[model samples]
Structures are given as structure tokens and as C-alpha cells.
Target: MTKTVRIALQGLTCDGCVSSLTTAFMTNPAVESVTVTREPSQATVTYNSAETTPEALCSLVDDAGFEGTVSES
Candidate 1:
């Protein structure tokens, strides 16, 4: 099954940050889609839950040099 998660992000400054975060999410083969917005400083990611977890996704953002936390909603 696939799962979608909203990750609140920090340290996003420009379009480049968006692109970078998007790329970081896509690097995971289980990721189906990623939408990042600088205005909201968040990313919506869809992925195969069987293959990846929300914690793992957040780690990717952290590895990319940003802070990422799963939204409660």
C-alpha cells in the first residue's frame, strides 16, 4: 500500500531548495511523488509504505541539510 505524508520543513530559501528537496525525496525508489513548496516550507510525499516509512522520508530531508518533521495532520 502507498502512503502520503506531509513533512513540515525548515531552511528552505528559494526555488533551488524546493528542487533540492524534491530530488532528495525522489532518490528513494519507493517514492511515487513529491510536491515541495517554499511558501509553506513543506513537502507532500507519496510512497510505497511497504518499502519506506515516514521516518525514513524525514531522514532524507535531514540528510539534504534541512529539518523535517511529520505533520500531525
Candidate 2:
């Protein structure tokens, strides 16, 4: 089964930052889709729990150059 993760991001200054995270998350095998909004500083991430976890998802965001934290919604 798949699981959805919602993340609140910090330090997203521009579209380029959102795009970078979008690219990184989309390339992940476990992630089915992603939506990031810079104005609200949030991202809705859908992924397979079997292949990944919230921690890993946040790591991708961190690697992409933004601060990320997960929350339930």
C-alpha cells in the first residue's frame, strides 16, 4: 500500500528551490507524486511506505537545499 506524507518546508525563497525539491522527490522510486507550494511553504508527498519513510523523504528535501519537517494531515 501507499502512504501520503505532508511536509512543511522552510527557507524556500523562489520557484527554483521548489523545482529542485520536485525533481529530487519525483526521481525517488517510492514517491508516486509531489506538490510543493512556496508561498505556503508546504509539500504534499505520496509514496510507498514499503520502499521509503518520512525521514527519508525529508532527507531528500534537505539534500535539495531546503529545510523540511513532516506532519500528519
User: Which candidate's lDDT is highest?
Assistant: 1
Off by over 4 Å in 2: none
Q: Which candidate is the best by TM-score?
A: 1
lDDT of 2 by residue, 1-73 (tens): 7988899999889888888889989989999999999878989999999999999999988888788999768
Task: Give, for candidate 1, the lowest lDDT window spanning 10 residues.
Answer: 38-47
Q: Where's the lowest-lDDT run of ten residues in candidate 2?
A: 64-73
| lDDT, candidate 1, at 62 | 98
Clashes of 1: 0
The estimated TM-scores of all candidates read: 0.97, 0.93
Residue pairs with backbone overlap in model 2: none
Which residue pairs collide in model 1, if any? none
TM-score, candidate 2, is: 0.93
Question: Any runs in candidate 1 off by more than 4 Å, and if so which?
Answer: none
